[model samples]
Target: MNYLVKINAVKTTNELEDAWSNEDYKALLARFEYPDAAQLKPAELKEYLFLAISDFEPHEAAAILLDYKCSDQLVDGQIDNLSHEMLRTKTFENYSEIDLHHDLFNINQLLYSAYNGKFPLGTVNLVEMEIKGDDNVEELTKETALKALSYGLSENNLINRLLSDQIEGHKAFPEAEGIVWELQHKGDDVYTLTISEKWLTKTEITNPEYECTVVPFEEHQEAN
Candidate 1:
């Protein structure tokens, strides 16, 4: 089920817009601050402004911010609202990290980057553990992985097609699917996709002429 967040107040619309245009996150926090309350410092204000303008639940985000100790700049009391004021305040930026081995900490980095456009600092040590209790969930079997490889692109998820290709190519032979695409925040784009071939089956495909009768592939049907 989808959750809803309600923000009831916008004390001064003009001030909010001005802050957004200038990317003045500190000023934005001060604007949203409760009257006669202590102001947040610049570092703390950056995170609070990000949380306030985000689409995520304010409380949930606030919890993360507090965990990160970035919540100190926000105002006290119940926060009930969704606003784009924060996004409008900053330009989109790209950040990436490459780790030789995967770790749970990597997931945390993804979480931070996805939500806040910031990367974590320092090295994250890892310890291996045996995880259990996941039997209820169906695993992505070979069949499902193979099928996904043949799937085509759609407006909804242009990135999915790239994944599909990589999985198919991998099943056929071993090769890295890294360097999936060159991302751009503007202009026409080109996407490079690779899928493992370990997943493909040699099946005859019947292509019909415009006047002939036939059913198109599932991918084509879905796209239409």
Candidate 2:
């Protein structure tokens, strides 16, 4: 019998200093109400952004963060006081997760509290995964795993699906488990798959879990 085995995945957090490069700066300035926002230099841009985001009420600031694709990310382990202070308070209050290593830093997972009512930005994307009941785990790929993690952590996914049985309790607090997956793609994009000894199995969100371990895995591979 191939009952699924499980391993530990850590919830690792990191900050990307250049997540938004000079290329992004132009688009960022374009959306702002500031007429000269696009013309601002480094120093001027920082001043303008800081002013625009820093002063609004918590809810408004959250909108700007998403709408503007704000540069800041929430992180742990000795983060500077100034940076934390500058980030919108609602993000932390409403809560979101951080994807440490990827092509682009996925900022907020839109776990926005409904206290402010829903908006267009409330929706997020989901990555698919196929769970099989066997030792033949070749179906799972690194790319697929990464996509699953992102979708699982997303507000829409969480609200829709209950992860308590998969990990410790989706984004298990205090006692976090590590998730690891790898895949090698050939001509047709099929994966040469390798994952942690324990793989993930998806569960329905409607089920109320009594004591499920919905663990949020930490990705060790960084984007090259």
lDDT of each residue in 15-58, candidate 2, tens digit only = 22444565454554454354676567765664565455434553
What's the CA RMSD for each of the models?
A: 19.7, 15.3
TM-score of 1: 0.18
Candidate 1 lDDT tens digits, 3-102: 1111111111101111122234444444444232236554465456554535555344433333332234333331111112122221011112111112
List candidate 1 segments past 4 Å from native.
1-138, 141-157, 171-224
List the global CA lDDT of all models: 0.27, 0.33
Q: What is candidate 2's CA lDDT for residue 123? A: 22
